[model samples]
Every structure is written in C-alpha cells, then in structure tokens.
Target: MTILGSHFVDFDTARILVADDDPILREFAAVHLATPTLEVEVAEDGVFALERLQQGGIDIALIDLDMPRMDGFELIERIRWDDQLKHLPIVVVTGREDMVAVDKAFAMGATSFVVKPLNWRLLSHQLAYVLRNAQAESSVRSRLHDLQRVSDLKDRVLRLSRQKLTGPLNDILDSAQTIEHLSTIPEISASLRRIAEASVALTRVHADMGEAERLTPAP
Candidate 1:
C-alpha cells in the first residue's frame, strides 16, 4: 500500500471508479475491473462522479469523454481546479479518438487515455499501470501526512507479542534454572523433562517473532 511499484499485475485487488452515460458501457467497464482481485464502483455521469469524488474513497477514476449534463473534459477541468480533488488520478475510457479530445483530456489533468469499444485485457493492464503510478504519487504525499501510522502498526504488533512472550519466557527461564539445580534427583529425569519443556517454549516465542517480522511492514 505504501509504494505502488511500477509493475502492472492482472489479479490485484484495486478500487476503481467508472463514469459513463451509457449503462451498458459503464457496466462493461465495471465488470472488467471486477476480477477476483478488484473492487469496482460506477457513476452514471460526470455529475455523479463529482459527487462520489467529493465523498472520497476512490483510488482511480475511469471516465467516458462523451456524456450528458457535464462531459468528461469539463469534469476533468473541474477536478483539476479543485484543491481537494486535484491529485486524483483520471483515465479516459471513451470511444472518441479525436486528437482534440485527447489533447483536451491531457490538458485537464488526465493521467492516461484508452479509446473504447472496451478491450478488457488492455483496460485491465492500463488500469493496473495507472493505479501503480497513483500509488507511488500517493506514497509521496502520505509521507508528509501519516506514514508514521505504518510504523506504528508494526511497532504495535511487536509490542503486543513481546508482552505475551514475557510471561512465558520468564517461566521458561525459571524452569531451566530449577532443572539445573535438581540434577541429583532420581536419575535427573524430572530435571531433563523441565529443561526440554522450557527449551520448546523459548523456541516458539522466537519463531513467532520471526514470522511476525516477515508479515509486518517496516515503517
């Protein structure tokens, strides 16, 4: 989540927004983004998209150039001008292939463009690429905002696990010391059993810590 690396993967669970006047087209795009890995949201038109953007929570917008009420270009312009929405990544998904339209879209702050009849594979690839770039950009901004939260999450896991380990580890150490002191007892069988149990307990704590470190993000 921190850095949306440069790679484009097909089965990645990404949140995508689609805005199209035609329900069929919108549905088509939405369905394509809905692989087992993706989460898709739809907006019927530019107006609806603006509302959704205001509400927030969208990772990327897949917009149609031709629409009713407010067109995609106008929507892009408004999005770029709005301070709150300025950084939102936009990808034009439309039938219009006119150079003028493409130029206008870029001018209005679109990050990528895809001419439509809807190629699912290509669209998926493009979306993944756009999302990755968006993530990189977001990561930069997140560093300024609350990246410390990621580190906090890692620290919290370590703290809780350490707390849980403390009691068990102390018990293991005490048992080991007791076993060492009781070497004279009946063949020393009880001492050996205690020492073996303590060793197992200590091994588990360290093993769990190693697994936790591999799973948790570092800052």
Candidate 2:
C-alpha cells in the first residue's frame, strides 16, 4: 500500500475520478495518480464526470477547466450546490495562463489545483495531501458531533435531577425535621392531637419517598 494513515478510512479502496477533455493528459493522470492502494477512473468531459460523481462511491475528483460539456468551473459550482456532493474534494487541472480562471476555480470551491504540464511529483504529493487532509477533517467533524450528543444528554439528565429529584427530596427532609420539632413540644408531647399530627406527617413522608423513587433517573 502506498499510503495508510490514522484518518480512520480504509485508504486501500479509495477511488479517484479524473476528468479532462484531452485523452493524453487523462492517460497521464490515470497512470501516475494510482498507487497500489488507489484506483483511478476517467471521465472525458465535465458532464460525464458529474454524472459519475452523482452516482456516488468516488472519494476525490480531479477536473480540467476547459471541456466540451460543462467546463470545470460549472462542474465545481454544481458540486458545491449539491448537498450530497458539496464536500467532495475537487482538484482543478488547467493549463490556461489566465490566473483569473485559477482564482475563480478556488472561489467556486475547487479544493486544490495543479497547472497543466504538471510536475508529476508535485501533483502526486498535492493529491495525497488533499486526500489525507479531507479524511482527517471528516474524522474531526464526526467526533465533534458525538461530543455534542453526549453534552446534550448530560444537560437533559441534569434538568431531570434538578426538577424531579432535588425539589421533592428537599421537601421530604423538611417534613422529617418538622415532625422531630413537633415531638419535642412540651404541651403536645403526650396529646392525642400530637399523635394524629405525627401519623399524618409520617404518611406524607412515605408518599414523598415513593414519588422521589419513581422520579429517580436510571443510569
């Protein structure tokens, strides 16, 4: 395998899509971009490339600016507009001396780019970096989502504790203290009324304890 990283994706089966009008450069990319672990697929023009992308299962796309059916800029625009494919990595491969096209491609959401008459080594390095970095970023987003879910669950439990458990338990403790105080009263100590009050207080305490137990949250 040419590259294996801690990004949590199976890099060995990663598929690449290369789109260009020129068969020569398309072949060049198809040959040079493939590692032992990488697979490369080619599209003759922008439209075909987009069709393939929409079908899914591709990891990254290398697009050429000048093409017959939908040029690279439109391809990039369409991909960004699409919710499913918006985050797909797109590398612009163009020979045009016009810096405007390069700038526009970036504005249009091209992830990376290499000029035509590509330095093979530089192109290889750049593509590798893009793939690895994309995997890392995706991994980070997934972790953040998981953390947010845990935080939300914790907030919910805390609310339940305060609203359902704390208030009722505090009232139960207060009732117990009131019963103790009533028992110490000199005149009522041996009176029938004091015994009745003690009975009522104990009954209420039992009910409150049952309610509190019912509201106790499971782990």
Which pairs of residues clash in candidate 1, taking residues 3 or more apart in a chain or in different chains?
13-37
lDDT of 2 by residue, 1-219 (tens): 143563222354588999999999889987877766678899999899999999998888999999997999999999999988988889898775868889999999999888878876567667777988888888997899998888668767655654675555556556655665667676654464545556566656656666655676554
List pairs with backbone clashes in candidate 2. Answer: none
Candidate 2 segments whose C-alpha is farther than 4 A from its true place:
1-13, 166-219
TM per candidate = 0.59, 0.68
lDDT of 1 by residue, 6-85 (tens): 23346456678898889887777766667666778998888999998888777788888898888999999989988888
Residue 98 shift from truth in candidate 1, angstroms: 1.0
Candidate 2 local lDDT, residue 75: 92
By TM-score, the best candidate is 2
CA-lDDT, candidates in order: 0.79, 0.79
